[model samples]
Target: MSVTRPVAAQFEAYNKRDINAFIDCFSEDFRGYRMPAETPSTIGKSALREFYISNRFNNPELRAELISRTVLGNKVFDHELIHGISPTPLESIAVFEITDDFISTAWFYFP
Candidate 1:
């Protein structure tokens, strides 16, 4: 699969609130961080699963509207409008690094 495939799957699964499908898009050693911060917010697939189950998958109305997507080699940058996570929608950027058909790392940024 192309590098962007897993990234695309991630958004689709997220919108559907499908925890299993969302986790499937990531590598076993997947790591997620907040942009401009060095420490990881989540490490490994199990941690990611716990994070989504606790903070995301339970939100029935959660959705990410893709505003734009830029792909450079194995990296995909997505600009989006995310809703249902808070009282109001938020604009954010998600940077994904894909390796061997799975997302290995991700960074999220909000302004």
Candidate 2:
């Protein structure tokens, strides 16, 4: 599968509020963190699922708009605008690392 596929699948599943599909896009050892931080906020698929369920899936109106994307080998960088999470829309960038057809790690940045 293309490196960008997991990233796309993740967003698709997230928008659809399909937790199982979202979890499927990630590796069992998945790790996620904030940009420029070495420490991860989320580790493993189970932790990721919990984070998404509590923070994203609970928001029925949540939606993300892709502003731009760039792919370089196993990495996919996505610029996005997310709505309905907070009082106003949020602009962020997420970098996904794909390995063995699954997302191994991801880093999110908000400006």
Candidate 3:
């Protein structure tokens, strides 16, 4: 199956602020990193859940609009326009690596 399913599912879950569903898109040992960082900012589903619950899902105004998506093999890249987390809209490129139908690793780039 295509890796795009998990990527798209997570996007929908993010927009809806559905923490459970959002985390469900990721693997149990998921690793998430912000660009330029050498280590994963968030690791494991438990950590991922805690981070998003406090930093994202709790923010009522936060929403990410998908600008575009490109998938190559097991990786999915997304161009996103985010609103409400800051004073202005933020542009980000997020890459998701899927394994066994779940996202195993992710990288977020803000430029």
Candidate 4:
């Protein structure tokens, strides 16, 4: 399967806030991190689902507007503006590493 398939599915699922579909785009051993930190914010499909449900998907206004995207090998880099999590639109870059057609790891960046 192409890396873009999962990445795009995840992106669409994110906007829809469909926890099941969102989790489906990730691997069983998924890992998510906020950059500059050594520890992952969430790990494994179960934890990833919990984190997004409680902290992200719960916010009905939460959404990410994609500015651009670049794909290289099994990696997908997305530049977007996030809203509903803060007072102002937050600019961010989400780097997704896909393995075996699922997103295995992801890193969030703010610049």
How high is each candidate's TM-score?
0.96, 0.96, 0.98, 0.95
In candidate 3, which residue pairs clash?
A: none
* TM-score of structure candidate 4: 0.95
**lDDT for 100 (candidate 2):** 100
- On TM-score, the candidate that comes out on top is 3
The predicted structure with the larger TM-score, 1 or 4, is 1
Q: lDDT of each structure?
A: 0.93, 0.93, 0.95, 0.93
TM-score, predicted candidate 1 vs. hidden true structure: 0.96
lDDT score for residue 1 of model 3: 73
TM-score of 3: 0.98
For candidate 4, write residues 1-111 as lDDT tens digits: 777899899889999999999999999999899998899988899999888998999998999899999998889999999999999999999999999989999999997
**How would you encode candidate 2's per-residue C-alpha lDDT over 33-66 as one tens digit per residue?**
9978889999999999998899989998899999
lDDT of 3 by residue, 1-111 (tens): 788999999999999999989989999999999989999999999999999898989998999999999998999999999998899999999999999999999999998
Give residue 75's error in model 3 in angstroms.
0.4
Error of 4 at 70 (Å): 0.2
**Backbone collision tally, model 3:** 0
| Root-mean-square deviation of candidate 1 | 0.8
Kindly report which residue stretches of model 1 are placed more than 4 angstroms away from their true locations once superposed.
Answer: none
Task: Estimate the overall C-alpha local distance difference test score of candidate 1.
Answer: 0.93
